[model samples]
Target: MTASVLLAADNLGVHVGTRALLRDVSFSLRAGEVLTLLGESGAGKSLLAQAVMGNLPAALRASGSVTLDGTTSRADDARARRPRWGRTVALLPQEPSLALDPLMRIAPQLSETHELVRGAAFDQAEAAALHDLEAAGLAASARQYPWQLSGGMAQRAAAAVACAGGARILLADEPTKGLDALWRDHTVAMLQGVQRRGGCVVVITHDLRVAEALGGQLIVLCAGQVVERGDARTVLADPQHAFTRRLVAADPARWPRRAAAPASAGAPVLSAQGLSKGFGGKPLFDGVDLQIRAGDRFVVQGPSGTGKSTLGNVLLGLMPADRGVVRRAEGLHATAFQKLYQDPVASFAPQITLGQSLRDVAARHRCAWPAVLQHLSRMGVPHDLLARRPSQVSGGELQRVALARVLTVQPALVFADEPTSRLDPVSQQEAMAVLLDALDERGAALMLVTHDDDIADAVATQRWRLAAG
Candidate 1:
């Protein structure tokens, strides 16, 4: 007998105060099937997932029917689905840093999910948790807190915990955002494992490689409307819609090699010698030395937990090196060095609107508010987004806003850590262009940390690789 439809949504719509964010979206999923949502940033992809899960924010309202395992409920009635959470449904949020509890150890978090949510015994839970961590290649980090793990490692841990409850219906939002190729494939395998167990998955992502790999059903959204829907491979291979075509073409693999020349001859912006860093008595990287010149683009490339971010922090003086000296050029303002953080939400004040945060930065830098607005415009950030707090906006939108904030300071050097990982291909290209253009205009140097080889190839004048020692 054919497997019954495990999940179905009908005429789903999401809105805030009559302003529709998502409209008339519908789909169904069966056991062993995967449904992937693809869209540009702020195109209501996440909102749709929230709608289906009955997890929309308080200000938003959802209208539709959500059917799970022959039971139907109002899409907006979150309470109706609360009991099913962690049992029948699970959501792997986009930002692992925020999703994982800060104070809890990774192993304990996984153990709790298995014991409490899955009704496993404590001993069984502990063993299962360790096994999960090992599968995610985080066995050594099982005892560590979320903050101690690198972004990619944390992403893996979060995935493990999300799946620990034995939830058959998984909603994974950008699950592979910060991962390297190995881990990316591993995550894809994990999702496939869910399918092999007769479960279904709903994934929201901008990663075409992931969408292509999942290869079940694909829905491309634009401005909250379905622009294209079909088999993932066929649609991506020969897109029919204009937006879909642009999205597919915007992949970094297709990007032309940059013609920009190295500015190594320019005056040094910063220099470091004999840099070393480690965690828990294990060295991540050791004895690294480098110099960054004005107008240079330096890329820090490495696998997860190899200390790419640690090196950036050490060079930026945000964190001290175990054994090194970093020298900055004289006559530069204290804010001459700014960083576009990997997690943009952490950089802003949670309680304040984005506008207020930008105003404060502008005031500190003696820049006009209009100048900040102009920078936001250059980065394609909407003016209305300024009214919301950092968590209220989409990740891609928040990332662009962060870059715009960085540019307002006219920094002499920028440490952009995986800055565009959350963005769709089209927005990724645009954001990179804006950043490079702004940096070139100001003759500023850049130290970028990313796992994307295409981006490194497209932008870096110099490359640095870190390996665990």
Candidate 2:
């Protein structure tokens, strides 16, 4: 007998007026199986996912019927909500910090979400919340607020929320966006747990590592159309579509050649001596020392909650270290320091337009308008997109804009915290190459924090791994 279809979407199309974002997307997902929608940025992966969940934005129009385990709904309903579907469907949203209530503690939040999704008693949900946290690699994050989480931690906690209510059909958008290997493994196990319970999962992701880890039927989308659909191993080993080939090739894991880092020459630009930091009297690292010389690509790597992000802040003088000093040598590149955060949205001003943000950064260094425009053009940002807010742009586009913002400043030291984590492999490769090449041209230093080992291997002249507490 054929596997039962848990969800089916037919002739789905999304458009804003005349422009089509997605068209003719049709797929049926079987229960207990994982179906991954794989594509590059703006390739209509997320749009299709949202369409299936009946969560399209107001301005866009969706023509489709989404059937969930027998109940069907129109895709264009703005009132489409999670609770209305209840345990029949659940979504692990794309941005964890945005998905959560910043004022509430994570424990209570998880319990509440569990109760809402599963229709369980509050007491039972509260008692079982720890298990969800543990599954998401956040046993200690129960009492923490959304603002306190690292990008990776927030992603995991969001996973906990998506799975908390035992929803049989899981719709996750880039669920492993900021996670490291250890936590990523845990997430994979969590998904498997759902499968073991005879549930279905549909994941939208740019990272091939996620697809490989989950072992699913892969559906490749490019420019709003499905180009290829096949078993994971067959398609991954030999993709039938050019877009799929490009995506598969762009993965640093599959890259045959890599650029060699320039020799670490000249005087040390930044030095950390016996640097140690802690929260609530617990030390994250002790007696840690390192020197970043001119042109050195220093890669800091660790699993989730290993204090890698904290280390970046402490080194950049944004936060105080409890035990040591971060020394900087004066008189170098035009701008002394700049950082690209894991989540660029937080770095952007809510009221500021994208163009203004770039110009503001440039003006800080006495940069000219012509130079700013030149940089913006090189980054492939249209003049029209400049007027939009950060929230209006896609994650990949926002990241590229952030890169444009930093490069225009021409800083001597570049600190990139998970710079390309959310980008599709093609975009990730392109963005990192641009950042590294720009740094080289200006004789700058880099302190890159990433969970991607392939990235560290490709870019780092030296590597540092922080131990988990």
Candidate 3:
């Protein structure tokens, strides 16, 4: 690699014992430019970033030459690599909440990081932190704790922290994972801000639209191998590899799938009349009316931090509605109601294996072990995954398992909150098809809550959009 290239990874490879996770990966990123790494799930995108940061999983062994600026650091040099992390290379972590101190406010956390990384005085760090938050479009969230900010706001805060370190090379992972269109656009602009300042950005994402938005060189990886590499427009317009073609064509809007068919109206099977909910003396949504018949795909679409999830809870009687009543069929039992939660890790006990969790669901719903296994198999989940815990498997695999566990109930109505949030594009399409087919076979009514416009359009039989206010 030449001296002009700011960050270069040459022949980088990662292996867990004998199993290769990343093979012969090579790329270079320069200042005032952005590089996009496009790949499906399990393509070692995150692992590559870990290797560059000199901190990978404990089980994995990295073999590669990572050069940041003019200094080269070997992957095994733990001591020598420590000083270069926040000083020369910084990471915009995927989960901001996990990265930040939960007990501290955003300002304090950013200021502390600035003080440590930039060696600034307390007053200087505080001023710089506020400026970074403003640049991140989160000035109002300076005093708010991590728990108080919305998903989009929290992501911006994380970006601000990475930038405040004054590192020349910035790495962002899935920067717009769960954002609405407005927030997604804003985030695009925020990432562009770094480029405007002549810094280098390497973005790791599976979303083709996000890759196109960043307008950079594209490197497509599959099965720990680089399958294609080219300019963004050239690659998207004319993909040479089959895998790249599939990714380019994985457009939910252009997919040949029918919208959820509406059920003929009679007596409403489920009805919410004048539903109102509030938090902290502020009304989230009020005077909302909804009705669901058999086979109804009721989509609750809105921006993040809206009352979509709360509305789902109220309808399921998990939480009380402030000024309304949810009337369901009088004879509906607990078996008739089920929920497919967003975060499967939080849903299951960490100590228990996925096999044990599935067994519990099977017993509660009177489903046979064979039937549960069949459900998991249909969602592209291998049987061996049953022996693993939530942490042992990927978030995508956990999502599929979560779907299978809930489907074993065979409910009359299902509440799916961001069910496909963790899945890659190809897996997302496959998983959604499986979910829709399962629901259709049983004629189950679905109340789906999400911020993705494409997902909202793909599955919505009827749309109920909540206000940001």
Best-fitting candidate, scored by TM-score = 1
* Runs in model 2 lying further than 4 Å from the true structure: 1-3, 80-86, 256-264, 332-335, 380-383
TM-score per candidate, in order? Answer: 0.98, 0.93, 0.91
What's model 3's lDDT at 219?
88
What TM-score does candidate 3 get on C-alpha atoms? 0.91
Runs in model 1 deviating more than 4 A are: 1-3
Model 3, runs deviating above 4 Å: 127-143, 265-269
Across 283-369, the per-residue lDDT of candidate 3 in tens digits comes to: 789988888887788888777667777788888988898998889977778668788775556677888999999999898778899
Model 2 clash pairs are none
Candidate 1, residue 204: the lDDT equals 94
How well is each residue in 146-213 modelled by candidate 2, as lDDT tens digits? 88888888988878887877778888888887788777777778888888898888888887877987
| Candidate 1 residue-wise lDDT, 275-342, digit = tens | 88888789988877889999899999889999888888887888988897899999987689989889
Candidate 3 overall lDDT versus native: 0.80
